[model samples]
Target: MLDAVADLLLEAGYDGLTIDAVAARSGVHRTTVYRRWRDTGGLLADALDAAREVPWEPPDTGSLAGDLTEINRQIVAALTEEPSITAALIAASFRSPAAAAALRSFWEDRYAIAAIVVERVAPGVPARPVLLASCAPVFYELVLLRGPAPGDELAERYARLAAASVSRSGAAP
Candidate 1:
């Protein structure tokens, strides 16, 4: 059912997604979907929750720049992919508080897991800002600014710059 929601979201977008569509897509009965999810927002939130349950871990790339570059590359790929699920979910988040909260929770968990890379940069540094410094550019350029998504090399450049900033700040050697 969650898969159906995701597929429907990708195929038709957030505004076009509907309970009937999801039910038909999944071959699940309408009443069952309604009983479980209640509405489109519920379905979206559950879909996000289901995604969160999937196994994921930040890369252990042997260096802060390497790890951050890998992370940034992933962001670029997700945003640039055809029928981008990440972009779709981000759009969906704006329309539904339930989906928003669920999306927020997903990021919170992702950050907590990814923060270990920052920890390697500085044992006790505030992880979020440092981590954000490395990856935020890709999102800002690709999503917010609607710029052409550059390949992973540009992502690596952002990571190098971020790592240099951290190093210059005496956070790491």
Candidate 2:
């Protein structure tokens, strides 16, 4: 059912997604979906929650730069490869409280997992800004500028710069 929701969300934006569509796609009874999810927002939230359960383990490349670069590469792939789905989710998050909360939870969970890489390298430094610095440029280019998605080389450069900044200053970027 969650898989069905993901597919439907990719096919149709949040406004077009319906309980009936999810039920039909999943071959589950409408009543069952309703009983499980309660409403469209709940269903979407649960679907996103379910999708996020697939853990994205941070790389243990021995160096913070390597780990951060890998993380940025993954971010670029997700934002570029699934632009429609990502955009739909982002739009839905702004309009739907359930989606917004779910998205927040998703990021919090992912960051907690990924923060280990930063912690391992910079024991006393705050990890959030360092991690954000590594990926913010790619996001800015892709989301704000509406430009071409950055490739791995850009990700690596950002990661190296971020790592160097944090390592040298013991401060978050």
Best by lDDT: 1
- The residue-by-residue lDDT of candidate 1 on 1-173, one tens digit each, is 78888888998888878999988989999999889988899889888888889998899989989999999988899899998998999999899888999988988888889999989767867888877888888888887899976788779988998888777778775
Number of backbone-clashing residue pairs for each candidate, in the order shown: 0, 0
How much does candidate 1 score in TM-score?
Answer: 0.94
Taking every candidate in turn, the Cα RMSD to the unseen true structure, in Å, is 1.2, 2.4
In model 2, the runs with Cα more than 4 Å from the true position are: 82-84, 170-173
| Segments of candidate 1 deviating more than 4 angstroms | none
Q: What is the C-alpha lDDT of each candidate?
A: 0.87, 0.81
Model 2 agreement with the true structure over 1-173: per-residue lDDT tens digits? 88787788788778667889999999999999989888778987886788687867789998989999998888777777864666677678877788888977887787778899998767888888888888787677766687776588878989999899887885443
Collision pairs in model 2: none
Query: How much lDDT does candidate 1 score?
Result: 0.87
